[model samples]
Target: MDGGNNGGRINVAIDGPAGAGKSTVARRVAEQLGYIYIDTGAMYRAVALAANRAGVLPSDADRLAELVKTVDITLEPGADGQIVRLGGENITTDIRSREVTLKVSEIASHEAVRLRLVEMQRKLAEAKGVVMDGRDIGTHVLPGAEVKVFLVASVQVRALRRYQELSEGELVPLEQLEQEIADRDRSDESREFSPLVRAKDAEVLDSTELTIDQVVAHILDLCRTKTAEAK
Candidate 1:
């Protein structure tokens, strides 16, 4: 997009914990604004998926870093949403599987892995007009982004959101899902490299009591305001 006459496109950075609706809200906001939506988390998950397939454990940081260098992960805007490709193989669905979910944080926590993917993310946003979302997008991936948002929600609410999205066959117990989400939060917050954190300039948004549409609308409003100010 041409930034609506400002002569420069705005880069939007969105960071949040799992199940805070970062992916969905960022996608819709980008669609409405005619900007590219980059799901940074999926990049890490693609790595995790590859590592899992190769029997590379998360504890093997050196091996995982090597694995990341060997694989080519690409994201393209698809008809439905962003399509994630690893080593030229479409793995949009595989990365979202429960197995990947349990291991992505470990893979993402490695300093080398984060360094490699962060470079890719920066390159993708160099031209601007991109809405990138992930645990550390605002803090590390696109620190100079024009607009930054930190989305949050209560643990209970977050778990429910995830359960609803991933539920199909036999339901996973709500309590179990809650614990899993909680565990992920702990790991994300305590990780040595690029641990989940709110950017100092980011606008904190609590979605605990808000719907997906509500959250997206709020972010769109913020983007509009920021872009208008720039003009």
Candidate 2:
């Protein structure tokens, strides 16, 4: 499907399960296209980190929703990568910690939380020319996005990739990482609100046998083709 141009800003939505390299590929694609890279997952992770710091359980939906309103989450483009700020503090690395990774899905599953965050996400992409990646970006956050790509890889491959990415500081067992990824997949797919599902119009790309550059190139090609068709 061709993504229609909106005020010359092309909106790209990429969705996938955990460890599918959505964030990395999305960043590179955005850089290549010179578009804003919005990591919706990281936004949720920021919230989870705050909730954890505040002693709010993931099951406390009401409190979590209130907490979301109180905190300010911002994403900035940095020389190295996107920097995530929560309430004016830099928690870019904190949100990626194991604790946040374990509870982000639960916090994100809250209906109220999703509503609030989705509103913010839509606002950020209102002008388009953005590449957003998340479990529901194509399915929910940006249903009208001109270019949508659903990236996927085998669980084992994704686990290995994640392990390698995190192996520099911590020594997590490969088997444990695999199970965590599987668990996250189940949680994200089984959630009652905005469960992870591929958008019908999104092109499914399997990255199990593909390199990062290859995936980025494929998506860039899609963007070029769709943009040209739109023009």
lDDT of 2 by residue, 1-231 (tens): 323435456899999999999999999999999999999999999989999999999999889989988779999999889999987898888998877888998899999889889999999998789999999999999999989999999999999988888846678999999999999999999999999999999999999999999999999999988788776
Model 1 residue runs over 4 Å out of place are 1-6
- TM-score per candidate, in order? 0.95, 0.95
Candidate 2 displacement at residue 117 in angstroms: 0.8
**Cα lDDT, model 1, residue 179:** 98
User: Across residues 1-231, which tens digit of lDDT does each residue of candidate 1 receive?
Assistant: 455553567999989998998999999999999999999989999999999999999999889989988789999999999999987899998898988998988888999999999999999988888999999988888888989999999999999887887747637888998999999999999999899999999999999998889989998899888887776
Candidate 2 C-alpha error for residue 22, in Å: 0.3
Computed on alpha carbons, the lDDT of every model, listed in order, comes to 0.90, 0.92
**Candidate 2 CA-lDDT value:** 0.92
Q: Can you list the residue pairs that collide in candidate 2?
A: 3-146
Count steric clashes of candidate 2. Answer: 1
